[model samples]
Target: MDHVRNANPFTSQSSYSRGSVLAWRIVTPVSWLILVITSIYYSATKPHEGKYSRHTIWGQNSHRHTPFALNSVIASLYWIALYILQVPYLSSLFKEDNTLPLTLASHFTAHNLLTFGFIHLWCRSYFWWALLLVIINWFNLTFAYFRYPKTPRVTHVAIIAGPLAWAFVSLYWDGAAAVHSHHTAARIVANVFLWTWLVYGAFYIVAFKDWAMGFALSILAAALGVGQFFTAIIALQWIFAFTIMAVLFVASLPVAAPGVFGGDVFKRGEVVSEDRERAPLLAEP
Candidate 1:
């Protein structure tokens, strides 16, 4: 069965053990729920006495403002949206006919747990440890993303593209905070590092036809530009951010071009009415 084939990538007929599948079903959701609770608790109780809370860290970073720091409000919205979208996508993976691959199932559980750890460390000013957890989580998500098919729609946006874009951007932001590097030379270095997003967005769009990634990167760039505009109204950083955002947004449009524009989902529009009529019959008894 296709379900068995997909659930265990080892072979078409191979399937994960009942106990293994049961554990994934239970542990994955539990891990995510734990993360959600802890995130809320931290956000609500931030600036805790005697601790360098998340807000404190951000405020310190803002005082020494790096080019990579994004608008906190926009970042919050992105996280909220990503968390909501992940629910539907995660549910789909466990559908009767769509069992998730073992690796992906493991990733869902481990990534959430690691992210929780990152938040805990980050709030306490353990910048180096937080960065390590984020890097590990990013690697797991990226590898699992490309290894599997981009289907069920939400996977592209929530599971990999959205989180991955944020994580990639966070590396620069968090690294700047970690080193407390806020000098002119450090700012110049940060500006140079920003181009990696453009390069990354373009390559994925061209090679993987990954419009979701392009869109995510565009939004992050726009947020960065907005934050920089307020931080230093006369600087070139905002200009660069807006320019990168515009280019990425325009290029990500779902045009008629094959692969480079609209992916298979859009191309499916080319299917004739005859095929639509035949699809129902193919399922008939």
Candidate 2:
């Protein structure tokens, strides 16, 4: 009983590990903040509803000012990439002594591969890119369940990086006129992607030992999940708004819980591993 009961939720560790997590998490709220501030400014200062008003309908295409849009891009990327890139930080949580971030060099270029947006110029407007994102989302969900074999770590990057990069490209390609013409069709797929990101991304964070980060994340999710409704991004109306608000709020509340991969990590409120070895701790039991 004691052996099974010994898992500590806040298992103390070297400053480096804790710092890595903290440093990375700092971007979470900041990115959200930038989004919030920019969203408000973007909406408030928007050109009075004339020709541009059509584009204003969808939050995706609303921001036109290059500087504002670019700033939003930077903050948004930092917010998301911090957590997604934590594939290394995540590996270290179950292992010890070794640098979780370092394991990438052994495989392929995880960091560079994450910059999938650069390809937008070449891969413009093809249905295949969207299809590829679908594959990547599945890989992320599968990896979240599996968590080892480490190959999925790169795919995890694809989870967000792929969609986000596409968002940038698609919105650019769609332009103001196309946005009005295809808002419904676009939202159909975009909503699916939104929920998918929320799902896998939430699961990834919950898999960690950081309860505080999870809770903070939840608060952000709730506010933004609800806020998205006001932005008119998803045309499904109140049901969609209420559902998203409820789900996002819930995601951050529990770090580890029963039925999460049928594991006791959360129900026990434990860290699950403290195996301070130099090599990455590939074994999880």
Number of the top-ranking candidate, with lDDT as the measure: 1
> Compared with the true structure, what per-residue lDDT tens digits does model 1 show for residues 139-215?
98788776654344565567777878877887877777788776788778877878888998887777666767788
lDDT of model 2, residue 244: 46
Per-residue CA lDDT of model 2 for 1-285, tens digit only, reads 433222221122332445444543444334334444444444335333432222221233333221012223433543455445544544443444434332322222222232232222112322244334434533443343243223233333432333333333233223322333345565464445445434544554556433333333333334334434445543553234346446645654454444564555444222233243243334333
Per-candidate TM equals 0.81, 0.38
How many steric overlaps does candidate 1 have? Answer: 0
Stretches of candidate 1 off by over 4 Å are 1-14, 47-64, 101-103, 255-285
